[model samples]
Target: MNNYEQVLVALRRVIRATDLHSKRLSKTAGLTAPQLLIMQTIRDLGEVTIGTIADKVSLSQATVTIILDRLEQRELVYRVRSEKDKRKVHAHLTESGGSLLDRAPQALQEEFIRKYQNLQSWEQNMIISSLQRVAEMMDASGIDASPFLDVGPINRDHEWKNPTQRDDRKPDPASKLKAS
Candidate 1:
């Protein structure tokens, strides 16, 4: 294959890897990547504010709030209004949360970070530069993306429906390519 085709294929491989791994993790741990990330962050930073977790995880406060809502429903985490400031809420892990976290697998990005850091300085710079160039080429510069790369289904509790039959969701652009 030519250079362009090769690049596209490689990109597809990366995406597929992330998607499949995310699905596997969901099935095994019953937690989405973002959920696990927030749990880990809470454990690492004791009784952290929602804003602090948002900053550490590179997610918006609104998004973090939604995830926290779900986690709270599951009884894995608890929130408290700061004693000094009732307006400031902080998240803390429950015993269940700690147990779940102990059993959860390392995030794909975390594994990648460990391996990447082991690489020589030149190799690391080259990879980062190439990825940045690709992001610029795709017109995705300044996009607010977290290190979490799970692109699979977000809500596993929702019944699975055919992609073509989902009226609530937009059509996938690649479906046309597959049709042709």
Candidate 2:
């Protein structure tokens, strides 16, 4: 294969590895990578605002909020409005959240980062620069992505319903693609 094909295959393998680990993490800990990252941040920050969590994780506030909803449903976290500033809210891990965290395995990114940090400074810089170049080549520069590499839920079954056939929501571009 050519250099381009090799690089594409390598990238695909990396993505597949990340996706596989994410599924394993979900099965083992019952927490998505984003959810686990949020909980870890809460543990690190000791009561942090949702905005702070979003900033630290490189996700939008809206995305964080949606993840927070899932975590809250699982009883992993609770939000409290600031006493002095009711408009502001902070996230704290629940007792069970803390217990679960103690037993949870390290995230894939965390493992990679730990190993990366152990490398020489120059080596680290080289990898970062190369990855940045790759991102730019793919037109993904400045796109919002968490440090964590987990692709959200995987649907291996490809169990999808046609948009036009659905009883809910309006038809759009995806339906057109399906028709073709």
Highest TM-score model number = 1
- Residue-level lDDT tens digits of model 2 in 1-180: 999999999999999998888777777777777787889999999989999999998888888888887777667899999998998899999999999888877888877888988999999999999889999999998876666777844211112233446445666768899999
What ranges in model 1 sit over 4 Å off?
152-180
RMSD to the hidden true structure, all candidates:
9.7, 8.4
The TM-score obtained by model 1 is 0.81
Candidate 1 least-lDDT 10 residues = 153-162
Candidate 2 regions exceeding 4 Å error are: 153-180
**Collision count of model 2:** 0
Query: The CA-based lDDT of model 2 is what?
Result: 0.81
RMSD of 1: 9.7
